[model samples]
Target: MSTTTDTAPITIHIPTPLRAYTDEQATATVEAATVGAALRALVDHYPELDANLYTDDGTLRSFVNIYRGDEDIRHLDGPDTALEAGDELSIVPSIAGG
Candidate 1:
């Protein structure tokens, strides 16, 4: 048996606070078949953020949220959702005690 998969290349906008973990780059481009895959690519590219972005259970952190353009993934399908080319994503870490 053989299987084939199609993946898209999308760009993720890294917020200011997370730039330090990404070598000061404001954005990064990754190729994957789904939102979850894209995030893993980001983690691979910036290993410093492994703990901050994901938990040991392979789930996104509670304080971290992902956006597909202006739409929140939590309301969509979490990370298992698929993304397309030219899609924009933002990693916004929830702030507290403001």
Candidate 2:
């Protein structure tokens, strides 16, 4: 038997702090079924980025903010947020502290 996962090619906007890991590219395109998958694909290609975006246990770091268009993934379904073809994602690092 064979199985397939329908994935879409989505573009993730790279923030300045993480651009070096992405070869200085402003954006990256990855095929994924959800936001989690898309982020995994990114780290797969840029291994160094994984440590910065996720914690030791594989959970996304608290300071890394991800948005699907105008909506925050945290307000949606977190990493399980669904994606469609050509979805635009932005990564905003929480760089400020109280």
Candidate topping TM-score: 2
Per-candidate RMSD vs. true structure? Answer: 2.8, 2.8
Task: Give per-residue CA lDDT, model 1, range 2-45, as digits (tens).
Answer: 22276778999998878999989999999887788899999999
Q: What is the alpha-carbon lDDT of model 2 when measured against the actual structure?
A: 0.91
lDDT digits (tens) for residues 3-46 of candidate 2: 23889899999988788899999999999989999999999999
- In model 1, which residue pairs have backbone atoms overlapping below 3 Å? none
Kindly report which residue stretches of model 1 are placed more than 4 angstroms away from their true locations once superposed: 1-4
Displacement of residue 1 (Cα, Å) in model 1 is: 19
Per-model TM-score versus the true fold: 0.88, 0.91
lDDT of 1 at 96: 89
TM-score of 1: 0.88
